[model samples]
Target chain A: MTNMALYKREMKGSIKLLVIFSAVITLYVSIIIGMYDPELMKTLDGFVEAMPELMASVGMKADAATLLGFMVSYLYGFILLIFPMLFCILRGNALIAKYVDKGSMALLTAAPVKRRTIAFTQMKVLVSGILLLILYSTILEFICAESGFPGELDITSLIMLNGGLLCLHLFIGSICFLSSCLFSDTKYSIGFGAGIPILMYVLQMLANVGGDAETAKYFTFFTLFHPDGIIAGESQAAVSSLILLAGAIILYALGIIIFDRKDLHL
Target chain B: MSIIKVERLVRDYGGGKGVFDVSFHVDQGEAFGFLGPNGAGKTTTIRHLMGFLKPASGECSINGLDCWRERDKVQANLGYIPGEISFFEDLSGTEFLKFIAEYRKIGIQNRREELLERFELDPRNKIKKMSKGMKQKLGIVAAFMHDPDILILDEPTSGLDPLMQNRFIDLIAEEKKHGKTILMSSHMFEEVERTCDRIGIIRKGRMVAVDAAASLRERHTRSYTVTLESESAAEAFAIDFNGMRKGLKVTVTTKQSLEEIFMNYYGGEKHDEHGAV
Candidate 1:
């Protein structure tokens, strides 16, 4: 189904990008976890009360007494979403569109491998990069929580949150991958690959504002990821995560199909 | 039997572009040269053979396997050098070759080393830093290293120096001698003349001429005027040349070079200044 040599080459090419993103996410995760305090929440609540609408728009919550709640409210909303989305966009475009655009794809297709195999292998590289990123953050978050505030974080909910985060990004990553497969030119690939996710993020922001704008959530896939809901033990969280996982699988399969069938100028 | 075959292959890119009803075949152990200008659909037809494209109207096959449907089987023992050479730029030339070897699942490194020496390519420098000729040499090495039976090269010597070009011509000749079937698209007439058994000239996506190289060379005809010592001598000279005799001057027709034969197919002598092909 996939070519291992091609997979390894792609991994080597993007490992640096994976490391840099993971490092930055680790830094933000630790700082946010380290800042968890009962008193600070009261002060932040006072600030949140002062500008409730503005606070809601950015997804910052006031009542974060529990460690998991504090982490979800602080990190999941903006920091986790933005960084991994950026990683997906860049990595996805680099995988297929860049190769085809630069004409190096000729080398890959020139071999005995099937186009389906090449696309599948590249899709694996993308999925693996996204998995490793979320996995690294999960491990780092566990380490930071255990060392700083012993037994403060709920182990299961934290795992659930990260799992949901992984699905969300996988879904996002597939969108970028599909765009990459759809266009042979990097310009158009980056345009749609970067554009669609950024639009969804904007819609998520507008929905977070919580007013007449709350209806906007229905339009964006980001609404399926509920870090706060997952921590609160909501059944909706499990359903949404499954939906996101399914979406990722479907998009990836579609990308492989399109790549196998489409004419490559390379 | 035909090892590579195309039958009425048509791929329409709209607005008077793309190959139209192009058909040709290379028999077992035969060397076929595809000649055309830059936009004459030479690369387009070759791309179809490599299975990077699907023909809209007709079918092409290799070893009785459909080029598009059974491409993996067809390409398994095929070697190809694309018109434009672009590699993983960050990798050293040696690293690129190794990756190709691994992808092709080649166990022996002897042929790769031999080709590296034959092409005089160091391949220690990064591909991005390598000169154009070096990159072209690298492409050639990669294509031939696998020891595939069928070779499809598109303008294989585009960036090589004169010396390297001759070396490449020799390589093709040797490969042909080894009974390897080859279909090479080239602009260099001398290279084709030396390597290919037959030549196909395409113009604006149409094959204008396809014949044995010897026959094409026989078609190389030009006229020359001879000033004889006397009218009687001129008349005698005109009889052999199939030309006219007028007093002391006789207009004689004779055979020209293969290059001129190609030029005649590409629409007459206005393009005399652009003579490299």
Candidate 2:
């Protein structure tokens, strides 16, 4: 549905940011992979024993002996999820909504290309960005894990963990992307686009406090991708992955449909 | 055949706003000027023709295709500069033009270069940094660079200095000479008078007058402010021509043209005498 020129242009516009995001994710994942200390792993259970509530509140695992447990608690639970989610919210809003609001989309719309073609092309940019980020971080972390732990790491489980994260980010990105198309003014669109994901992130955090708020975790999309569950090869990873994939497809289709029919006030 | 056609187009924006039952047509190789004051539905009408807005009741088309349904096909023949020019301000003008050309599939740079040189525009500067006139110049080049058959410009000369405005007028004249169809909306009477073969004046979302430029001008009455050597001479001249006299001066409004007729019908303040003028 899209011409090569448009796809290439969209890619060219964001390749710089893609490279920067990949580099940052790779660096963080590599540092986490290298931070596996077997000696520190044995004594780690004592801290959890001392203050179980405080440890759970901060998303710290009591048993951080194994490399997988350390990474699940130290990296995937917060930094990795939050970083990609932020990237998706920012870039997804910029991809469509900001362009339409600023009248730059007018320039593209005046051309021979269809609105769907423009949309699909930008979607490629977004999907490719997420894919490349995952690819870079996974490869870099794999190399670090192999050298640091030497065959002790379950490679398949690690791949599944990253895959779950990818699906989660795509779902988050699509929410922002859809919100961007829903309104003409940036104030409203940006409010919805950025607001929803941040709300979900906060809900997940409060849910982890493990009291009355524990049930609130069920409400957020984040509940699907439990870092420790993913590293342990739990069923939640597989189920959440499917749900995120379905939600992402629906939101993206809605974005294109609304964008095609809505009046461009520009 | 008409290159651009708008029929019974009504788009109510609420609170008594938006265009109402607007209808007009511009034939092939004809320049039609749409004249209206601020908020008089000129831009709305142009946007309809551009397929940017869907009418509430009626429809508009270019080259016989439905404006909304077949906009992609219709846009192939159209070149436009929106009322408010907006661009990718982060990119330099040259890059932005190149991006448009790439989308337009115009591999040749001659026309784009010629337009840049004609407008005295150096498209190397960032669009955010460019002055309004320069951005307007860039918009003109981007629109004309493709050499489209139809041009839809809304207030194309609003931000430009007078010299650039004249340059734009000359450009339109050249485009007109090439047998191109153009619909331009503007507040300036002289530019429309100079370039358009026919002119339509719209007021409050309603088209008040439409006529051939030559006939509209020839039939219009002229206004002359004459100074007399004597006070009695002024009063005598006023009496003779049905003009008004004040302190040795006689002010006589000209014959009513299509413009005067429009104003007269609306009973505006500037030209108050309806029957007398």
Residue B64 in candidate 2, Cα distance off native in Å: 0.7
Q: What is the DockQ of each candidate?
A: 0.72, 0.66
Put down candidate 2 lDDT per residue, A218-238, tens digits, no spaces: 888888876677777778668
What's every prediction's RMSD, in angstroms? Answer: 5.0, 5.6
Best candidate, DockQ: 1
lDDT accuracy of residue B199 in candidate 1:
94
Fraction of native contacts in model 1? 0.81
Chain A agreement with the truth for model 2, given as TM-score: 0.90
Per-residue lDDT tens digits for candidate 1, residues A158-199, read: 889999999999999999999999999999999999999999
Q: Which stretches of candidate 2 lie over 4 Å from their true place?
A: A42-58, A234-236, B219-262, B268-277
In angstroms, give how far residue B150 of model 2 lies from its true place: 0.6
TM-scores for all predictions: 0.92, 0.89
